[model samples]
Target: MVALYGALFLSAFLAATILPVSSEVVLAGLIVAGRGDPGLLLMVATVGNTLGSVVNWVLGRGIDSLRNRRWFPVTPDRYEQASRIFRRFGEWTLLFAWLPVVGDAFTIAAGAARVNLGVFVALVAIGKAARYAVIVAGGLWAMA
Candidate 1:
């Protein structure tokens, strides 16, 4: 049981990063397998995923200094485009941080834009929790 929860957490965490992990698949499988409490699984996944976004935020904070380096992952034009969109949409975009590739970019942009941490966490958590809740409900419904 503990191992299942841990794996879910790790999967959720990695899924939020640049890595190609898919936490949703792990979560759906666990729910279908009846391996853990659905609510607890949802909570674990949400927290893990939110913390993973935080990692991206932290990286964004330091990205400016390294942006000029040739080895930097994001090109200036791409970074600028993301920044422009973020600025246009404002911090409210953090609520969509659960989105796949785009979500990671949003978190990073929030950090670069110096969004308030409290706002970031609150919005991100709400979005992630809501997503997990839907997944949990769907999995339960399928079982029914």
Candidate 2:
């Protein structure tokens, strides 16, 4: 059980970063196999994901060369959109910051823009926790 959760934590945490991977599939498999505890699973998933996001935040803050990539040229439209989001949402973006593709980018942008790392982490944790909680709860409910 511990091994399963650790694998889940690492897998989910890593997947949430800029790297392309997903733990939800593995989570579903575990739920299907009836392995481990549901509550603990959620906790592990959330913690792992939050930690990964923090790493991404650190990277984003330090790496000032993303714009050099072909995929990431400095465009006024993007900057304007990010600016508006930052201006209006401020720290609230962290709540929805777990939503699929957008979530990863949101966190990175928060770091690149030098947004308060603490607030960014807090909000992301809130969202990440809720996401895993919902998934685990749903899986348990369905199994029941």
Candidate 3:
């Protein structure tokens, strides 16, 4: 059970990062395997994913310092565009942080724009939790 939880957590975290991992597959596999309580799985996955987004948020906060560094891949125009989109959409875009490709960008943009940390976390948790809940429900249903 501990191993299963750890795997789920790791998968969730990686999925939330720039890496193209799919935590949903790990989650559904666990459900199919009947490894742990569904609620626990949901909680673990959500928290791990949310924390991963926070990493991007922190990176965004430091984007200015990192911009000129060769290690930083985002171009000036690209970063500016992301910041602009966040500015236009506002904090609500954090709810879509669970999405792929673009989701990580939104979280990073929120950080670069210096969004209220409290609101950023709240919205991100809500969105990520909701996504895990849906995945759990769908997995259980499909099993039945």
Candidate 4:
């Protein structure tokens, strides 16, 4: 049981990063199998995923130093434009951090924009928890 939960947590964590992990599948499978309490699974997944986004945020915070290097993904002008856009409309986007691909981008943008950490965590957790809650409900309904 512990191992199952641990796997779920790890999957959720990696899923939030640039890596192509899919925590939703793991979560849905666990719920369907009745391997653990649904609520606990939801909590573990949410926390793990949120922490993973935090890792992206941390990386973004330091990305500015590398923007001038040839290896940097975004041009300085583009990064500045993104930062400006994020400063204007980015915080609210954190609420959708549970999304894939773009969700990871949003988190990193939020970090680079220097959004308040507390605000970032609250919004990200809410979005992630709500997503998991829906999954949990769907799994329960399917079982019923």
lDDT for each candidate structure: 0.85, 0.73, 0.85, 0.83
Error of 2 at 119 (Å): 1.9
- My TM-score estimates for the predictions, one after another, are 0.90, 0.83, 0.89, 0.86
Task: lDDT for model 1, please.
Answer: 0.85
Show the lowest summed lDDT stretch of 10 residues, model 4: 71-80
Candidate 3's TM-score:
0.89
Going through the candidates in the order shown, the clash numbers are 0, 0, 0, 0
lDDT of 2 by residue, 1-144 (tens): 678888998898878765666877777667767898777777788888888887767655754666446544224355456546766777687787677756766666677778787888789989988877777777877788
Candidate 1, 25-135: lDDT as tens digits? 999998888889998999999999999988878878888785677754455676676778799999988888887656877888888888888888899999999998999
Cα misplacement distance, residue 91 of candidate 4 (Å): 0.9
Model 3 Cα lDDT, one tens digit per residue, 13-98: 98887576899999988887788999999999999999988888898899878667764535566667666777888998889888
In candidate 1, which residue pairs clash?
Answer: none
- Model 4 TM-score on a 0 to 1 scale: 0.86
- Candidate number that wins on lDDT, 2 or 3: 3
Model 3 clash count equals 0
Off by over 4 Å in 1: 67-78
**Candidate 4: segments with Cα more than 4 A from true spot:** 66-85
- Lowest-sum lDDT 10-residue window in model 2: 70-79
For every candidate, C-alpha RMSD to the true structure in Å: 2.1, 3.0, 2.0, 3.1
* Best prediction by TM-score: 1
